[model samples]
Target: MDSEVRSYRTGGDEVVLDLTRDAADFVSGRGDGLLQVFVPHATAGIAVIETGAGSDDDLLAALGDLLPADDRWRHRHGSAGHGRSHVMPAIVPPHCTVPVLGGTLALGTWQSICLVDLNVDNAERQVRWSFLAA
Candidate 1:
């Protein structure tokens, strides 16, 4: 198994950062295998979604509706409703495994790997990419 961990500064805002290019770069020159993308943060998650078509915004809106960032959570610490960020992984999940053929990710035309972060207290995030040869 080959693996690498990448870190990024997400700033203090909710975002859906695209990571397709990074994944491609990591698997460059590699062969068929499974690409596992995992986030080592409880307040963040990994998601495969259609981006740049308002889908990202729609996702954030849906999350807001489902997990409003208000003072209604018991796990209060950082920002109000920061606990919702921890609960995000339950719905979006913290990892995703995609098929890599000929060193390329087998994702759909609009599907993109993104880092979903809602935590306003932390600005740094790490994503681990592990490839298991087939």
Candidate 2:
């Protein structure tokens, strides 16, 4: 297995940063295997979805409706609705495994790997990428 952690600056706002390119680069020439993308944070998650077609924003909006960042949460500490960040992982999940075939990601044409960060307190995030050859 080959593994590495990469840093990303998500700023102090909620965002869905695309990571397909990075993941592809990491698995390039590595042959058939599985790529595991993990975010070691309570407030962050990894998602495989279509991007650039408002799907990203729609996801955030859906989450906002589902888990409104308000004072109703008991896990308060950071910004308003910070507690919602912790709950996001339940829906989005903190890790995802993608199949790589012939050194290429076996994802749909419109699909993309994205980092979903709802925590406004931290501007930096680390994603661990591990590849296991088949």
Candidate 3:
């Protein structure tokens, strides 16, 4: 298994940062394998969506509707409803395993790997990419 970890600053806002290029770079010149994208955070997740086409915005809206950032979460600690961020992983998940064929990701034409971060309390994030030969 081959792996690498990288960190990014998401600032103090909700965002869907693209990671497709990074993943492709990681697996560059490789053969058949499985690429695992994992976010080492409790208040963040990974998502595959069609960015630059409003899909990313739609996802954030959907998540807001499902997990409103209000003063209802019992796990309250940071900013009001920060606990909701912790619940995000259960809905969006913290990792994704993509198929790599001939050193390229087998994602749909419009699909992209993104970091779904809504936790304003924490702007630092770490993502790990692991590749396993097949």
Q: What is the lDDT of residue 40 in candidate 3?
A: 89
lDDT of 3 by residue, 7-78 (tens): 989999889999999999999888999999999899999999899989999999999999999999999998
Q: Candidate 1's residue-wise lDDT over 33-57, tens digit each?
A: 9999999999999999999999999
Model 1 regions lying over 4 Å from their true place: none
Candidate of highest lDDT: 2
The estimated TM-scores of all candidates read 0.98, 0.99, 0.98
Q: What's the lDDT for residue 85 in model 3?
A: 96
Q: List the residue pairs that clash in candidate 3.
A: none
Cα lDDT computed for each candidate against the true fold: 0.94, 0.97, 0.94
TM-score of 1: 0.98
Residue 60 CA error for candidate 1 (Å)?
Answer: 0.6
Q: What is the lDDT of residue 104 in candidate 2?
A: 99
Residue pairs clashing, model 1: none
**Between which residue pairs do clashes occur in model 2?**
69-81
Instruction: Evaluate residue 37 in candidate 3 and report its C-alpha lDDT on the 0 to 100 scale.
Output: 98
